[model samples]
Target: MTINFDKMFTFSQPGRRVFGFGTISRVGKEARSLAGGPRAQVITDSKLMELGLVEPVIEALKAAGLETEVWAGVAGEPTQGLIEECRKDIENFAPDVFVGFGGGSSIDVAKIVAGLMTNPKDLHDYFMKDLGVGRFENPSKPLLAVPTTAGTGAENTWLAITSLDDVEGKVGFADPKIIPPRALVDPGLTMALPPGITASTGIDALTHILEPYLNANTNPFTEALALQAVRIVPVFLPRAFKDGKEKEARFQMMMQATLGGLTLNYGGVSEGHLIGQMVGGRYHIPHGVSQGIALPYCLRYSLDIFPEGLANLANWWGIDISGLDIKEAGLELIKASVDLLKELGMPWNLRQIEGVNRDDLPEMASAIATQPYFITTAASCCRKINTEKDYLWILERMYEGNFLD
Candidate 1:
């Protein structure tokens, strides 16, 4: 409900989106229209390759009469080294069009590689940091994202996240030129996702929606997309998790993820992502699981600041908030999110993640406080997180899994 009217904001998304069941068949046709030459490249992960998902995309590209190369090297979170490696492999191939055909990681690699191909800069220069000199001087090759998962919303957003191993943190390239001009979102592609992935990614999508919607830096356009996507998560996420073949559930979740990405483009994320990125980068936790663990705690931290927004969220989830004060209703919303995390079999505390310990909290808190991206985006959070102590307070609660307290 809170909007910053002092400064103007801009909203953007991919130029075109094709969604529905069996839309993968149209990738060939779409690629033909976007291609400047006969060469095309598909960036994805080896897991998807083993699962037999990458072949269909390659076949689609080849069917359109294009010479295609497959880079199935993307694994785990994208790193600066990985991006450079992918860039080296493809710089010589020089594809006129790119098909990012997997989860967020693969799509992110595709986006960064496409950008580097045209912009002649080290991947580190584009990192979202104080000293980062990333500026795309030329337009990137046309990219078409094909999201096989219903979580990351990477297919629709321009930002590409990468891990900085030496710093034990994550950063992104925030440039409009890196945004995919077209996307193919087919729920059918996610049919083979295991229950664990279904749950984690679904929770990841929820974090993306909640952070932007609840943040002070939001607009009518962002709120509408976020609200719609938020409603779908409670109803459909469980169904999709319980049965991966649930067609309607998968379809709705995929739609929610795409909309969540759109909200990120306009609204952006805040504290939850900041903490999640840091912990995930330091401990090698899965991105969605890290976000899922931090989401309710972050919401609770900001509850008093966004009572009306939280109350509205409770109503959307069909919770009866009659006769309750706005703060109480907000607490109910936070409890619901925690409950959903439990239902999805996600970790409820930071301690549950491997490589995380009580001693690491101070270092993690300090890293978040000093991180350039966090420092810039912290102003947009409903609750101010200005110092190491502020971050430590939240991190302590997260470590102990203390929700109400």
Candidate 2:
């Protein structure tokens, strides 16, 4: 198949990305620079605070003469209520800059809070207008993202995701203005993450790379980042999962996660993300966990449409599928993906996750079928999504753990 070099694509660059070990200590200086003053708000979850990650940032901010307010209330996938709760704090304290200081959930909450400060609208107001949300006229205050986990690349992307109480699935607020002005990603912050989170988030980052790499909207820049992440994740993720204290493995996983973010910004994602969002939103599954459950089958389902892209991914994993048909080659990639999940002791099927049932398949399928992602444009998505039945089929297979069959 011939490639389309003429395909037009846009990329969003993070303002100031400081990636390395021990860089969280620079949060104070970065916040001061962005805030143009000493007032800063640190948004994170109670878990990270309990793990002793939040204090260092607060202490560093104080050491830099910055007055800091701690909002460690983030929980689960951020919801409208969670965002509103944080919004109240932002409204009352009114800091000069906002620092999102933990994982994707924490960072996502901060993104909405920052936007709310300037937009003065409901969360639904910022939903993609196509989805009947309001429009964002002004950019939010200079928000800084400090991600603790290696997935959800929410730190670098323009999209903020939330689970709405009144809605059945996740909603994304896609606005260029929401992209953070700076990100301080330190691998040390992830060292203490348990193996379960490490594996799940690693798969999420990998899916971020995979979907965009297969997206019809892909460009050279996005493909480059996605390919690099593809080459790195399968190797480093296992190491990070087995031993969270492995610095080099943790560092590499962190880098790939950010690259995954960049890929989503430029190339966009396809079926897997759409389906994963449904499972995550309805089942209350973590984004990464749902990605782990959905990606293998999603990729296999799209193999015929994304042969070249999926074939290249197999090659990157060092599989020699030269003589095999695309289906065979794609199967090789599927086996590799599932093997990685097993090696990491992660659940490769929906059944493995507690509370999942076959009864939920129809609702999950309907949710994904209505997503903007399933409604493709002229050249946005590579796969031909048969939303009416294909989604239900995938969900059933996922529920049954029917990978090879």
Q: Give lDDT for model 2.
A: 0.81
lDDT of model 2, residue 71? 94
User: Which pairs clash in model 1?
Assistant: none
Best candidate, lDDT-wise? Answer: 1
* Tens-place lDDT digits, model 2, residues 1-405: 435767666776878899999898888888888886668898999988887878888998888888899999998888888888888866778888999988888888888888888888777656663462334778898899999899988898887777666655566676788899999999988998999999989899898887877767767776677667767998899999989999999999998888888888887787788778778776778888888889888877777677777777787788889898877888899899889888988788988988888887897777566655334321256545365588888888888888776
What's model 2's lDDT at 298? 84
How well does model 1 score by local distance difference test?
Answer: 0.84
Estimate, for each residue in 1-405, the C-alpha lDDT of model 1 and write its tens digit.
Answer: 777688587887578999999899999999889999999999999999998888888888898999999999999988878988898888889999999999999998999888888888766555545732144668899999999999999988877787665544566777789889999999999999999999989999888887888886678886776667657899999999999999999999998898889888887887888888888877888889989988888888778667788888887877888999989998898899989999888898987877788898999899888766667667654455458887787799999999787
C-alpha lDDT score of every prediction, in listed order: 0.84, 0.81
Rate residue 52 of model 2 by lDDT.
82
Please identify model 2 stretches exceeding 4 Å from their true place.
Answer: 128-135, 371-382
Candidate 1 is scored at a TM of 0.96
